[model samples]
Each structure stands twice: as structure tokens, then as C-alpha cells.
Target: MSAPTEVPHKGLITASLMLATIMQVLDTTIANVALPAMRADLGASSDTINWVLTSYIVAAAIATPLTGWFSERYGRKEVFIASIIGFVAASMLCGIAWSLETMVLFRLAQGVFGAAIVPLSQTFLLDINPREKHGQAMAIWGAGIMVGPIIGPTLGGYLTDTINWRWVFYINVPLGAVALLGCAAYLPHMARRIRRFDFIGFAALAIGVGALQLMLDRGGEVDWFNAAEIWIELGIALSGFWVFVIWILGTEHPFLEPGMFKDRNFVTGLVFIFVIGIILLSSLALLPPMLSGIFQYPIITTGVVMAPRGMGTMITMIAAGKLLRVVDARKLVVTGLLLTAWSLYIMTGFGPQMDSTLIVVSGFVQGLGLGLVFVPLSTVAFATLDPQYRGDATALFSLVRNIGSSIGISIVTLLLTRNTQINHTELVANISLLDPEFAARMSGQLGGLMQSLTLTRGEGAFWSVINQSVNAQAAMISYVDDFKAMMWVTLCAIPLALFLRKPTARPAD
Candidate 1:
């Protein structure tokens, strides 16, 4: 909206922006832990309960690209303030929703209104701060973006356990109010432009993004391509994207400005952010289930163990902010990637018997790595781009990162499910009376137990023990496999850092 220059009340402005950003980002994962409680209260089936999440995700995906156009046409300050008001109102509506249908509708409204807050906040920070402080600015911004999701489940779980699931949504009320006031009072007004909207292009892109999100969110539940619904969604997604690309390339005034792609640093940064999103959110998606299902961790303990990751991220992000002043941004990115890969490699060593120590350690290391990367990546992505395209660029940047997160979570989850089944089958196949080791064990500790009970009871107990052991081992192996796969993904992203050109030095204001 506004050019990068000296601005008054920068501190207040940043605080306001971050509040809104955190409020919006927190909702992304905060509702996850409350799903079960919601399911019971709303009288929803297991299958239908997920619409609470899917509705928000799809609505956000479809609405996000509009941020650029809305900000340009309606003024960034006005749109941002309106988004906060709408989001808070929607949160309240969600909190008080009486049925599944109403909850999904409220959540969709929340997503649509909340979609613009993040990108606009980023644009504001970039606009308010000069180029030299971009790393610091981004570090502040990155902390909220990264740490919000990390703490979301913990907060949600705590609220749900202490009070009820409704508090999860209700909690946003006070925070949103403060943000709304701060923003309305201090956010500078940007002049609106009278540009023509590209309805066709916007429609096509929205369809593509919406369909893609739906496909990803529904695929695992529906057995992926085996379900006709998944196939239809996939086809629609591909077709929508193809048409959008073709339309945008040919249109005089495209929905997104094509020139944004010409910047090497910005383009490269998108690729990196996409990968970061995968690593960040997918690991988060995997950890809770692994902890609760395999380790038998209660919600609070799982939250505590997971808390270190966010702490690590916050610590390094601040450090990286300062580090950017002296170090090469590309070098910092490479180091971050290596550190992330190293953490994932450690995770590959996970076992059913291991304690939380390894999980905490690996998570912290990964957090450090992500923090090191995020600030510099955010700074560099916008460093070489023209201010005119800042709105669209930031929106696109967020969209790509989110899409990456969706795709990543889907892939890892699918792999975990399939691999666990395969591992379970293979492990079961190895068990036989003819195998000497199996027979020895059965005769040793197993023989004593079997002797302690009747024939029918002993046989039942024996098979139950074997099944439980097999299932745990199989699931653990699957978790490790997912970790290994992500490690390779982190490693693969390292070379892309080489393609980033250091931003040319900017003159002092």
C-alpha cells in the first residue's frame, strides 16, 4: 500500500499487525483438537465432522487471492480493519453455533474474512520498515506465523479440557478486539486504485485452488483415487488450473500480475517457502497422532513436548534477524535446510520404546532450522520486487506456502497409513510356530503366561498381545519412514538455495 519509508508509531503498528496475524494463524490449527468435542456436541458423524476444518480451508484458499485486488481497490487499511471485524464476529458465531451446518457456515465466513489478514499484515510491515530492517521485520512476522500453529493445539486442548471446546473459538474475541482497535487507530491509509477486476481469471484461480484443497483434504478419507469423488475433484482441480494459467497468460489485465514471476529471488523464495510449509505443518500434523496413539500421551503432555519446537523457532528467528545484518541470506538458508534435514534424520531413529527426549530434541532442532530460514526467506522474497506488486506478490507467496502445506500433510499421512498396513502385514507374516526364535519366545516368557491361564483364555490373550505389539512396531516404523522421507525433502531443497541471487544493496533513506 504505502512505500517503505520512515513511519511514526512503528511499534504500535507492528504490534497491531502481529495481533491480527496471530489471531488469524492460530485458528488454522487451534480448532483441530476440539473436533471430537465438537462432533459430540453437534451430533455429527465422524465423516461429516471434518467439514468444520475443510470448509475453512477451502474458503480461505478461494478467498486468499482476492487480498491483492481488495487491498488495491478498497485501500489496505479499510480491508484489513473490515477483515478483523468480520473475523471476530465470525469467531463468535462459530463459538455459539447450534448445529453442524451452522458451525460449518460460520467457519467458512471466518476463513473468507481471515484470509486477507496475513498477507496484508506482511505488506504493512514491509511498507512501514525500510529495506535494512526487513530481516528484523520478517523475523517478528515469522515468529507469529511459525509459532502460532505450534501453540494452537496446546491452547485449544487446554481450553477444551478446562472449560469446553467453544472456548477455543471464544478466546479470539478479546484478542481480535484489541487488534481491531489498534489497526483502526494507527494503520495508515493507502490510496485506492480504480483498476478493472479480472472476473474470469479470478473465478478460474478460485476454482482451481478450492478444488485442489478439497481434493487434498478429502483424499485420505475417501481412499484417494479409489473413490470417484477424489477423481472428480482431481479432474476439476487440474482443469481449473490449466484454464486459469492459459487465461492469465493471455489476458491484458490478469488476476495476478505476470511480471511478479520475473524476479529470480522472489520466484526462488516461493519454492523454498513451499518446502518449508511442508516440513513445518506436516510434521505438526504427524506428531500429535503419533504421541497420543503410540506413546499414550495425554493431550497436555503432547502439547508440552510439542511446545519446544515453537520455542526453538522463536529463539532462532530473533537470532537470524540479527544474523541477516552480517551473513549472506543464501548461506543462512542453506544452513537452515541442513539443520532441518539433520533433525529429520534424527527422527528416523525413533522407536516404540524411546522417551520424549528424542522427540523434543529433534523438534527443537527443526524449529531452529526453520527459524533461520523463514526470516531471510521472507526478506529476500520481497527484496528485489517492485513495491507496486507487493500486494499481489505477498498474497501469491502465502497461497503457494499454504498449498504446499496441504499437499505435504496429505502425502505424509497417506504414506504413514499405507506403510503401517504394509509393515504390519510383513511383521505378521514372519510370526510362525516353525520359526525357532518365535517358538523359543513362546516357550520362554510366553509359556509361563500361557500356563497361568486356561487354554481358551491363554490363546486369546496370546494373540491379543502379539497383535498389539505388531501394530505398535508397524506404526513406529511408519513414523520413522515419514521422517526419512521429509529429511530427503529438506535435503533436496538445499540446492535450490544456490539459485537465489543476493539482493542488491539498497541506499539509505
Candidate 2:
């Protein structure tokens, strides 16, 4: 293994890298809130407007694996710079897009360019920093990766409500420009290596990832496996993944180097990161709707309520960075997972009539837990791996994390929808005019009002009110169940921390 690269303007390079990373990561969720506005402006149907998001996701998934090959064949600095330019340019195009078709095209271009920014950024940070500083470096990187999604919707909602939805895309222009210039000026140039591009492997992986993303993203909208489209996508995804694995194992020069998996730390890190992705994004996915739909909080208020989670993550990440020097990384991971699970457990107590205090407290604790886990887990994952494979390793790491998030969000959403109906059915089963007890309670509570308004038990108005209450209660219960489910998921990941080996220390430079 080669010595880590020594760069003088490490801070500037890191700033540039983070700007690019935050820019890319923010796009993943930032556009979500803007979808309705985009649909109205672009004259798109409810079903078709989703293509705007789907295009970007599918494009990014297909293009992410190419990061390693691109960085190695072309210089890392060169590819990084180009990606920034392309991403920024695409963002501008997306902002100015005249039609849904144009918007989707621009977003596809944006995803293609932005796909390399994250893994490359991680690779660069790991390269420039010394072994001892890796904890701090990863903390910074993880903050952007984790926090961007947390804040994206909030920022997007503000932009849409205050100005226009286009600003969500336009906001990237300045950030991307700063990142582009900084990277071009301060980022070190890595030596380019000539490697044969594995077209077969690339195609197979692309097909698999793209299909899987489509299935996950589209599943909720189409009601999951009830729709034939999901089944077909699932089959294609499985077949593609199967072929990719088999081909890579047999091929002399695989798209992704198989040797990377042999590193115990790296493999464990992948699993850990996958679980983290699920926990991080799935909770984020569940919160906004719960706050806005059930609590009647406005978009801005929802963002504000959720802000503490990000704050806690940021604070803990800084602390965790320093803690890594004196603490076992594996132990920190266990502690973090426990904290997250505890937070989720708190969330299970949420009710339709409760205040935001519990939400804030639980989010903050989860943030702290996630921060503690992310920095050390990232540092340890790469500690024993060869620097030469960092590009591919980081790309694979990002890909797995994303897939995990998609899966988590989809599963939780599906459950939430199904459970709400089930709960509603069970609740309604007990409420019938035929039952004397139920009739007496209703008459006791509303008999006077019913007489004044000339309303009766059989009236549509009275039943509508009852149905609404039942629906709200059912939805609230479903949300709590989702939280409880997530808590269990977090607990399941706790034992996996034991599998992680502590990284050996290196002498200071």
C-alpha cells in the first residue's frame, strides 16, 4: 500500500469536495417537494410528473458504478471537475426546462454527472488525510451525506412556497460553481491508470440497479406487487443481478474488483453502511408526512421541527471524530445503534394529540447516534483496505447505501398503507348502530346537537364525521407501528456491530 497523499490546502479541497457532495446529495430529496409545482407548471399529469424523479434516480444508479473506472482511466481531478460542470449545467437546464420531457432529460443528465461526485469525494478525502485524521475527515463527509437528505425537503419546501419550484434546481448553480472552481484549483491530480473497461459487467450491473430502483420508486405509486409492472421489474432486477455476480466471478477483469470483498473490514463496513442507510433515510421519509398530513403542520414548520435531528447529528459527528482516538470504533457503533433504537422507541409513543417535544427529542438522539456510528464506521471500513481500491470501494459503498435506503423507504411505506386500512377495518368493526352500547354513547355525546341540527345517526354528515375520526386514529396508529418496526430494525443492526473489528492505529506523519 502507498502512503496517503499529502496536500497543503487540505481545507480548501475538503470544502470543494463537500460542496459537490452536498449539492449532489441535496438533489436526491430537494426536488421531491417541488414535484407538484413542477407538474402544474409543466402541464404534466400526476402519473407522468414522477418521471422527472424516476429519470434522475435511474440515471444515477446506472452511472454510479462507472465512477471507479472513470476516475482510474481519466484523472480523478479531471473527472471530478467535469462532473461539477456538468451537474451545474444540468441544474440550470432543469430550472429553465419548458416541459416535463425537457425536465426529465435535464435531470437524467444531472444524475449522470452527479453520480461520480459523492464516491469520488469520499475517495479524495480518504486519500488527502492522514490515517489519524480519517475520523474527522469522514465525519465531515458523513455530515454532508447524512444531513443533506434531512434538510433537502425543508429547503425545497421553503423555496417552493416562497419563490418558485424552479429555485430548487437553480439553487445548485452557485454551490456547484464554488465547488467546481475550488476543486479545479486546489484538488490534487491523481495518476491515471489504463484498465480495460468491462462492458458486459457494466451492462449487467446497470440493468440490475436501474430495474431495482425503478421497482422501489414506482412500487408505492402502483400498489406494489398487485401491479404487473412491479413483478416484471422484480424479475428483471433479479436476473440482471444474478448474471452480473456470476459474470464478475468468472471474468478475468471484472467491472468491480472482487478482491475488495476479501478485506474483512470493508465487507463489514458495507453491511453496516447498508443498515445505516436504511435507518437514516427511512425515518426521514416517514417524518414529513406524519408531521404535515396528521399534525397539520405547515411545510416550513415541519422542516423546523425536524431541524434538531440534523443539529444533533452535526454535534455528535464532531464529538465522535475526537472520540475515535480513545474509543473502540466498534463500541462506538454499538452505542450509536442503541441510541438510534432508543430514539425510535420514543417515536413509537407518538399520538394524534401530542406536542412536538417528543419528536424533537427523539430526532436529536437519533442524530447523535447516527453521527457516532457513521464517522467511526467509515474510518474503520477503509482502515485496512488498500488505497488503490478506494475508488471502487467507495463507489460500491455509496451504491449499497442508496439501495438500502430505497428498500427501507419502500417497505415502511407499503406497511404504513396496508396497516392503516387494516386498523381502520378493525376499528370500524366495533362501531355499529346495531350495537346498543355504541348507540347510547353516541346519543349521550351528540343527541342534543343532533336534535338541534335535525341530524340523525343515519345521516351522511354524522357518519362523515365519525369516518374522519376513525381514519385519523387509524393513520396515527399506523405511524406508531412504523416507528416500532423501525426500532426493531435498529435493534437487529445492533448485534452486527460485534462483527466489526477495531482498526489498528498508524504512526503519526
Task: Record all residue pairs in model 1 with backbone atoms less than 3 Å apart, i.e. clashing.
Answer: none
Please give, for residues 137-208, the per-residue lDDT of candidate 2 as tens digits: 999999999899999999999999999999999999999888988999988877888999999999999999
Flag clash pairs in model 2. Answer: none
Best model per lDDT: 1
In order, what is each prediction's RMSD in angstroms?
Answer: 1.6, 2.1
Q: Could you tell me which 10 consecutive residues in candidate 1 have the lowest summed lDDT? A: 500-509
TM-score, each model?
0.97, 0.96
RMSD of 2: 2.1
Q: Could you tell me the TM-score of candidate 1? A: 0.97
Alpha-carbon lDDT, every model:
0.92, 0.91
Error of 2 at 433 (Å): 2.8
- Candidate 1 regions exceeding 4 Å error are 452-458, 505-509
Measured on C-alpha atoms, candidate 2 has an lDDT of 0.91
